[model samples]
Target chain A: MRIAVVGAGPAGVYSAQELVDAGLSVDVFDKVPAPYGLVRYGVAPDHPKTKRIALALGRTLGNPAVRFFGNVAYGLDLDLRDLLACYHAVVFAVGADDDRLLDVAGEHLWGVGSAAQLVSWYNAHPHADDSFAHTVLAAREVAVVGAGNVALDVARMLVGGPHRLAASDVPERVLDLLARSRVTDVRVIARRGPAQAKFTVPELTELGKLDDVDVVVDPADLAGADDEADSRRARANVELLRGWAERPTGRAARRVHLSFRLRPVAVVGETAVAGLRLDRLGVPSTVPAQAVVRAIGYRGAPLPGVPFDEETGTVRNLGGRVVDATGTVLPRLYVAGWIKRGPSGVIGTNKADAAETVRALLADADGFPAPLKVGPATVPALLRGRGVRFVTWPGWLRLDAYEVALGRSGGRPRVSVDDLATMLAVTRAGDL
Target chain B: MTFVVTSRCVGTKETSCMSVCPVDCIHDIGEQVVIDPVECVDCGACVDVCPVDAIVHEGEADDPSVVADAYRRFGLEAP
Candidate 1:
């Protein structure tokens, strides 16, 4: 059976991997000339280890049973109708790349942006824009609003310094920013107490371990907030946090304050962020800051011609089967990953997630109506007719090797061809 | 004996290995606080987080040094 997986991120690639292992012919499509969507873009550059997921995802796309159509966007170059006509079934694994807004006052101010944008910029994502600089580097202090590992990552990136970041696959320009940064204080603000934080303890511990950076926790904030160390993780987080609070203050250059029980009410600046207005229980207070990062959460955008839940930012699905607004299952359409569920869980979470959807899909495939279009040649013909310059699996490999060659290996991440043109040119050059 | 930190656990030792396993002391995944909330048949935590799901990608559980290094990443004594 032929299957089409839209998107080549962790979700899409994992879905495709499942299909290929089942001895099925699959085609993976992506907007960029390269694949491994967020693994290459969203992951923090300092954590070069996480980016290793790209190597495995890349191997799956190279599988003979799978075909990659890079630079071919789903909504634009091809739609649901086009996919269903060519393949028996389609799986949409598009991850939520859109940033969720803080929805507070003064968010329109110059010094506010999301952690996702900052991450994408440093990772050299093709779509990363310049606003990241204006928002993140606007002042000497950064107020990161959220309680997840992403908040920790942002805290690390902001003041972790160039010497620490240089070892990873970080882009040179981002490394330069860290080196020249005047930012000294990074406050990780959590609306609730530490009990509700989403960061895993070990990752939190890693943030604490950064050289020359002191992770300070206020004992008063812990007592002031309504905190109940209900779960082991929460207890562990609190214990670790208390340890930081009890420790003698260090003579570190930068400090990461794990502040809790404070909810951001406003960005608090006329045209740019100078302070963050916060509410502590009932008390109103403003904390000095230059820029603010909204690391609250992520939401999936509705793909064209697909059923999406606007509220949850997820594709409406039951056990991975696409269900409509009326709760009717849409046949031959399946979903996995963040779109399948809300943006939760880590990279491994998607594996089991994709497996469930694939199980349902395999069961339903026997009854699926065969595609009206025949042969592997149909997709290339259709795309070519639309003037879409797509990159094949081999083409992607050449680009991959090209990038690796351009990298300093142990130092800077491969000089990312942050523009689609360079990626397309690199892939096309290997075509001949 | 519970699972040993193998060479395969190199990169994501914290994110996947420690988090998923219930028995291991270095469970970073305790955001669920202890172990994976989702039930897995023979989940790696069974043997102290094995090469399954995210970590088992290339299945290179062959290197002794790499295994020790992965264990060292979390300050856990390698089996």
Candidate 2:
């Protein structure tokens, strides 16, 4: 049985590994040269321990029955019809890559960027450029909009400073840029009170350990005596935030200001970001800040030939079966992870999502159409014909080696290949 | 316009506004209730579940736009 998993993120890699363990040939494709999508690029570099997932995912890539087709874009390189013709099943584990735009005026101005772009630039996502990141580093203060783990990660990165980032896999360009940043104040503003914050306990706890970072929370911002599950969780998080806030100020430490009940009205700056205009709830008042990074959440793109609900930003499906735009089931197609469900939950949530998709695939395995007979040699020519610049397994291996060598010079584990030319050149030079 | 609750209130069993609504946008806020705006989409599922008879429809009482605006201010998109 042959399956094509479109994406090399946790969902795709895990699903492919599960299918291979169940005795099937799986081809994993990713647009980026590297595997382990968000884990490598979206995650903050200071959290090297959280990045061990990449090493575990590397084992899945090494599977003999599994093939990694890197730098192969889905809609651009090979369309949905092409995958349907070739594989027994096609699973879309593509994540929600698009950032939710802040609808307020002045959001498009300079110094305003999504948490996705910031995380990508620092972690060296190939598509994230240096110019955008430099604009953010130039700011003296930043206000992160939203209360999720990503917001915490961004705030922590801004406050963690150069020493904390040096040993990690952050790009040298990003490090040098951050080293010069005078970012002293990081205010994490949330529209809701503490109880409504989406950050888990462990993530909230990690902020307390940062040496030069002070956590701040106004007592008035705390939720009232509500004992509901959400409120209780918020209370705990607030208690943690308050505990750190009460501590003596650290010498030369940056501040992580946790503000609540504040909705961003607009980003306030003419050329570059100067501040954000925010509406405070209850009393109905407004506030302003120097810079704003909206981290409300991520939303998935409408996949070509897939049933996507625009409101929910998810492909309409039932138990992992792919449905059409009109809700009709598509044969041999499945979906898992964030694309299937709107962006929510953590890494472990993908396991259940993938398991359901796998069950559907296995249940209908006998009905799979015969795959097109294309070997290793035919793939390159076919991709070239389609104008697809797919990085072969060997190409990815070369890029991996090049990154390791680059990292070695800086006394780190790996550096990232941030563009197509450098990655291709490394492969062509037989660097692997 | 005063916002009215529609038919999609299938899963919501508890209404917390009966005691809390200052203008009594809800007639009783306690019992089977209705938003009494002249434009009310009088699908009062909230009426059956309201712990108090505090919900009021448009013609049923005075204007509730001020109270409705409070809900909107909290970032809850008005019904």
If scored against the real structure, what TM-score would every candidate get?
0.84, 0.79
lDDT of 2 by residue, A1-432 (tens): 788999998889878877998999888989877788887877678766556656667778878888888878888888887787667789999999888988998898887778888888888887886675666667678889988989998888877877887778777777788889878888888887777788766578778778767787776665471443344445667678667656666564588888887888877678767778878753444334455788999999988888888888988888889887777888888998899987976664676678889988899898876877545444456677766666666777777888889999989987776766787676662222
Candidate 1 residue pairs that clash: A169-A413, B3-B47, B3-B48, B19-B29, B30-B33
Locate the minimum summed-lDDT window of 10 residues in model 1 chain A.
A224-233
TM-score of chain B of 2: 0.33
Model 1 chain B scores worst on lDDT over the 10 consecutive residues at: B33-42
In terms of lDDT, the poorest run of 10 residues in model 2 chain A is A225-234
Which segments of model 1 are wrong by more than 4 Å? A224-227, A409-413, A429-432, B1-79
* lDDT of each residue in A1-432, candidate 1, tens digit only: 899998899888888888988989999998888888887887777666556667767778889889999888888999989999999999999889787888998999888888888888777777778667655764688899999988988888778877876566666667777677788899899998887888776568778788888988888866733357766567778888888989877799889989988988988878878899999988999989989999999889989988889989999999999999999999999999999998987776677788889998998988899899979999998998888999998888887777777786544456666777888888992242
* Candidate whose DockQ is highest: 1
List A-chain TM-scores for all predictions. Answer: 0.95, 0.92
The number of the candidate with the highest TM-score is 1
